[model samples]
Target: MAKAKNDSLFSLIKSLTQTEKRHFRLYVKRSGNTQDVKFIKLFDAMDGMKNYDDKEILKKVPSIKKIQLSNQKAHLYRQILSSLRQYHISQNIDIQLRENLDHAKVLYNKGFYKQALKMLDKTKVLARDTKHFTIALEVMEFEKQIESQYITRSIENRAEILTNEVLDTTDIIKSSHQLSNLTLNLYSLFLKKGYAKNPQEFEEVNTYFQSHLPKVNFDNLTFYEQLYYYQAHVWFNKIVQNFPNVYKHSLAWVKLFQSNPEMIIKQPVHYIKGYRNLLGSLFQLQYYSKFCEVLAEVEALSQDKKVIQNLNTEVLVFQFLYISKINKHFMEGSFDEGVEIIPELTAKLEKYQYKIDPERVLMMYYKIASLYFGSGNYRKAIFYLNQIIFYQDVKLREDIHCFARILNLIAHFEDGQDYHLEYQIKSTFQFIGKMNQQQAVQKEIINFLRITGKITPDQLRDEFIKLYNRLQPLSEDIYERRPFFYLDILSYLESKIKSIPVKLVVQEKFDGLK
Candidate 1:
């Protein structure tokens, strides 16, 4: 039996919204062969299935032979995609531009050169305005073809004009492509090795960014060129731990979309990304007011069904909304409030598990663990941290994995799972070694946790104070603050020393900030 999880057609049908399913059904019915088509029967069977089982499908639709099932599923998949294409082509800009280009081609082949040229002209402008440079280039090629074969004296200078336009557009596209490539490389570096934790690391990233950056005339750049220009700088600044520059470029990124609000609808993925970076920068800088304002805008946009119609956009909406909610609590020391949303958030995470990036989902787990820890539910915190520690996907995020192990140790220790504390300590050290993340802060925390069981209960408070004093400076150290960012070990120790709750310590720190 074929499992639903392994069936592409089954997954696709399951992914569709009710409206889309209705559209596909109506489309099949309009074809006039719905009752006799095996593919349609297969579609209905799969759609109704809670799980994909080939044996069950064969039982439900006896006409489909077992040997022919795969082919039928493939045909159904293609039909669904075709229906979806017809449904969404009008709503998508790139599809509209491609259709125009295709129409122009058909007209040209029919010897309607004048009509073809007219269509190309309109599409070229739309494509250029939307930064659909590849499509614009194709349109230009079509225009050139029409001009060569059906030229009139009125357009005698058209060739030269078109030549210059092509060259200019090509230059802009090349520049944008290069900037985008550089930005992606910088982002990959960030995922592999977070923000530079030391002066040497910062210098290395800065040098690489400076060397790879393309030279361009910034003033004459197109919307995409300008966006990529700012995006490249934003990632570079983020890597070098220059939060001020990160904010500046991130704000510029958001402003570009704001100035061209139409682009937000036309290129929503980029728009969401810009907002994400802007929100992240605000959170890092603790700009609570502006963060809240931008977060509200994000929430408002997410509520717009039209804006989030795309499955990818819907996933991003869930990500940004939930992450921002967690950050809001983190900023205000409101872990209890943060805890209230976990049930809903967990359900969404499971619902969108395949669509959302694993790294982001794991980050939520870390945040949830942090919330539990702050609220003094150490066992629950440990429960969440265990999810991160045992997660088999190593490519997600090394820093998260590294810190998760450290946090797991602290949670276990605080929850009085001291019998296995030594074992966990050794296991974490080995994991850190395997991950190649042997930072001073990680070592310090691991060492303290390792020795806690050996300390007499009478000296535990003194030992906590000693560990607290030693880690306090490291927690503040710019080079060693990365781990501290993930788990507030210092605050936890302060709570232990003062005989108060960790949440209170966090609240005091937040109050002191004001």
Candidate 2:
């Protein structure tokens, strides 16, 4: 009896075919025994039932048939029963459909796009026949996205190939639109990597772009225009350094700027850049007169206070002052005639003094002294000269030497007795001597005294030659370049000391010439 029951159980398990499986699922669900068979559990059981062949169990018991009959109460149960009965007739069909769909998804994820498409082609045909429009549309979108990725990858590969080859600017010009996007990307890449491998190409990239850029429509450019404009300016600046001759057309730049202030101002700072270059070119050409003419026009156009303030803060103000000062110094003018302009200038300096850098402020002091000295306003010259000497660093020995001469002249000038020339002379010499013992600035005091009329030219010349001869080698070691300034004074003193009419005093360590 035990052996017979075991055989019966095994047979029943084998005979659970698709139809019997569906009947079993329905019976399990509604049989108040909602415990053993959930939907997934029953579905999995039906999946295995595709391979089951249990003829003996079907012949042995009517229990499975009884369960199937119990499931005929509702329309859904009837439909389920009928579908399962049909599934039993063709056991392997659902398994093949599921395997095919699973294979399609794996191919899609692995980027085997063609194979995935082939699988999807069959899937879509089946889905359409079954009227699954939503699922079909999803597959269509996935395919479209893949096609877009293919096009993007093709374009990227073409760009990489072009980068490896020689780039002809002429070809780029002809195919500007197609090449424009790729060229812009290449430019950014080259800039990032320091472009050491292709330095020359990188340098000329902007020149090519600038020449071609104007022809390229601004609105049509896909790049951020601001970056393009910055590139143009950077290129032009370098060009100006190498070939500033292009800036000879100051009038053209001025005219362009005048006609379209808004546009020129907005034009990437590159368009108006040639003006500064033009200023430099004018200086080099010694077109001082024309330089003055051009600069006046630029200054007039840039008269807005905000613009002037920006220029000053950028350190370009020093450049402006330099050009103006050079032009004023060389352009024809009476020494005293320029003195009347000082008060107006003093007000300007006061206005901008807080904004000025220390180096420029010292330059301003130097300029003021030069103007005063040229006009023979010795007191004012002495005042500004003192300011410069006090403020400047001691390492600037050349300027200090010149300042000493100025002090000597001021000490000798009419109404100049109030200032202490000797004290200043001693102080300057002491400071320089401490730093460099070989320097002989103190030995020149006799010539300064002659300039002040405290000694005759003959006395000064004798003293100076004596001091120079004794200190000449020492001066040479201290001063790397030329030694001795005041050539005119040196010449005159030489003449006086050697004159037949004058009897020079030569001091000796004796009561009389031994």
Candidate 3:
């Protein structure tokens, strides 16, 4: 029985496109019952629902009893999957390979050994062509089983050639296995402790990565093996704040596909992921020229039918494209102009709300709020910040939540809402205390904001300079640098001391980097 969660049948139905739903209707109707079939009625009820409500489903589909709902839902789930598989067999190589293998199995079972061997050979060639080594190995194993048991001897010394082929394939699979494991663990480390917070953390990550990294000859690796190798290096460098190595490896990852354009079509996700990492590394390095170069490619990808045809790829391309676009604004310090993207970003967020994760939504809100705040649009900034500040699941990205509160306090203070300022500052302090997010940076900002009201107008410039000087050293302190990435308070302080917009100060710095 299909378990009844909000996700089970309801999510699958919601995930279907109009075309898929239409195909499903025709698929189910072929049974001759049309919409009256039990599962078909259930699917229709679920599809029409805005939310998953099993009780409401019973009301709409009166023919289905509570006792049989689970079984019927399970049947519909399998039927939908089968229909999709049949619909997309041409696009999905794995499905095609597996179907061919199944045909070979039927031939083998019917005692047509020579025919089965011929089919297996063709399927193996297709699998290898697609870099589906695991499937190729399975085909080889089936071939071995038939040749050993049936004595077909279809080709001379076939056993020797077959053994060597399987051995070579296994070696390549092992390289992929090792490199993928390293990459996954490195990513997991980043998720647990973002960007090695201190020297000790950096050393720990470096040691762990070096210990696990396999020593493989780059010239000898298969494409997937090389891709994972570069990915692992990119993750390790990113976590340790080694932007130069990140740029190198992520570029290699991108070029790996550029040199093998066919792989780009087969592995669109990895291709886009390479570009994503490349853009990130370039952004961190403030390599504006390179970032723009890659951003153009990303724009092209957003329009490429081959890249965005699959639903998953479309979601990823949508996300990576917008993120790159927003970062371009950030790099130029054109936050006022950046706000122009808010409507489109907001609509896209709503479009993929269920498909996107909470962490992604939280970051988008933070980035939007940061843009508004930087542009001197305090009320709009606070509006977006409140999205992250009051996000129900604070535990999801606590750092974003913490930083959102800090920015909210600044936004309120800047907006001249002194009536609300004291309360918000108090709230922020308590929130930080609870989250244990206190660093020199946070403490300095809190104390400065707490006392800003008492400073006389003439003394404010000196105080701003004092705050900037005090916080400037912390930016070089690896442990204390984190808060800056979220808020860039030092730049804001410099803008205040100079009586200029934050964007000018940031743009000057960006120009220096170039």
Highest lDDT: which candidate?
Answer: 3
* Best-matching candidate per TM-score: 1
Point out the higher-scoring one by lDDT: 2 or 3.
3
Tens-digit lDDT track of model 2 for 363-464: 456556555654556678667767666665644434343444444444344335625655655565565456442224344543344355466545755665
Total clashing pairs for each candidate: 1, 1, 0
Candidate numbers sorted by lDDT from highest down: 3, 1, 2
lDDT tens digits by residue: candidate 3, 1-92 = 13333466787888898989999888877878675688888988888888777789999999999999989999999999999998878777
Off by over 4 Å in 3: 1-7, 29-36, 392-395, 417-437, 477-479, 508-514
lDDT of each: 0.86, 0.45, 0.88
TM-score to true structure, per model: 0.95, 0.36, 0.91
| Global lDDT of model 2 | 0.45
Q: How far is candidate 2 from the true structure (C-alpha RMSD, Å)?
A: 32.6
